[model samples]
Target: MEENRKYPRVRTGYQVRLTHRQYGYWVGSVANMSEGGIFVAELRPSEFTLGLEIDAAILGEGWDKGLPALRMKVIRIEEKGIALAFVEPDYPLWDSGKLSESTQSPNQ
Candidate 1:
């Protein structure tokens, strides 16, 4: 089937720390990403509703510790994890030098 997504997802392995009122904080690996949102793997924590916003911080070797957390809303959920859309989509976050060469997929 043809993909109908406005943004094509690129597979990624970046880690993220998520914070929520009910769930507190937890770490999960980013399964993929696009300019619009990110798919965090192994993030299933209790029951999460659609449109529920959460605080997220990308954590990895090259990522800066000073970067502030992002406000992301749950858009979709699968058995493995949840897909979160940026509450305020900032295109620069995707193209920023901070993402850097180290975090890109092998094919990129």
Candidate 2:
């Protein structure tokens, strides 16, 4: 089969937490990521529907400092997980020590 993705995806094992308008919040791990989207592994298919909009924040490592939440739309569903497309073309990834500097209290 020919791959038709605009952005190349890389395999990743990052943890993430997602929030949906109807579903509240849930946790999942990212199986792969691309500039355009991400495949969330281990997410229950029954908990999501195609076209559902959600906000997600990458968890682990630098998350204790701060990570920006991304707005995405559920595009594909499979037996293991769901695919989410980022609402914006450009979304930033968190790096260790980077967030702590920006998220620090002024009083400290």
Candidate 3:
């Protein structure tokens, strides 16, 4: 395994999408997230590969705003679903339209 920067990431509860293995699609929630990667939960480990493509969206409330088509890659697989290391994770909270993207897990 490669060395990680060990950046402190914030735990967020957001809706995400991953390609289904058998057919159709599967959904996941953001357990935690950093600029480099995200830990998603409630996913089928069997449906992921070392370099699987994952499409995730930061589901929102009130206004129903989220990120654009996000593209990520699976880098590790823990006890649960594969860990997705975003090849390009862009949570542009700067965009006035995306200002709400940083809302931590509702409980956080």
Candidate 4:
């Protein structure tokens, strides 16, 4: 398969909380991540649908203490999980802990 992704992905096992206006909340772990998107694993198929808009928050150790919820759009659905792309490319809050060395700002 051809690798045409704009951002390189890092394999990770960070917990994630997914929220939708209609669906409430669903929890899963991040299988991998890139600047553009994330792949969440172990999510129930019935919890999400393709093209759904959602808000996500990364949880657990090493994550930012005040990690802002991210707005994402479902781009792909796999047998085990779903892929979500960030609506905005710039996510300073998402770059905390193991992901990057930048410090979180209060105004973000």
Candidate 1 TM-score over all chains jointly: 0.74
lDDT of 2 at 6: 93
Which candidate would rank higher by TM-score, 1 or 4?
A: 4
Alpha-carbon RMSD, candidate 4: 7.4
Which tens-of-lDDT digit does each residue in 10-108 have in candidate 3? 877676776534556778877888888888888877767788776656664532564465678888887676678767536653655554746745674
Model 2 C-alpha lDDT per residue in residues 1-108, reported as the tens digit of each score? 999999999987689889977769989999989999899988788889899989989876644546468899999999999999989646445455675766888887
Displacement of the residue 42 alpha carbon in candidate 2, Å: 0.8
Indicate the worst ten consecutive residues by lDDT in candidate 4.
93-102
Off by over 4 Å in 1: 89-108
lDDT tens digits, residues 1-108, model 4?
A: 999889999998798999988879999999999999899998886667788999999987899958679999999988889999988656454534564335555566
Cα lDDT for residue 68, candidate 3: 68
Which is superior by lDDT, 2 or 3?
Answer: 2
Cα lDDT over the full model 1: 0.86
lDDT, candidate 1, residue 48?
72
lDDT of 1 at 34: 93
TM-score of each candidate?
0.74, 0.74, 0.64, 0.77
Q: Compute the lDDT for candidate 2.
A: 0.85
The sequence of per-residue lDDT tens digits that candidate 1 reaches over residues 1-108 is 988998999987789988898867878999998999899987664567798889999988877899999899999988889889989755455646678778889898
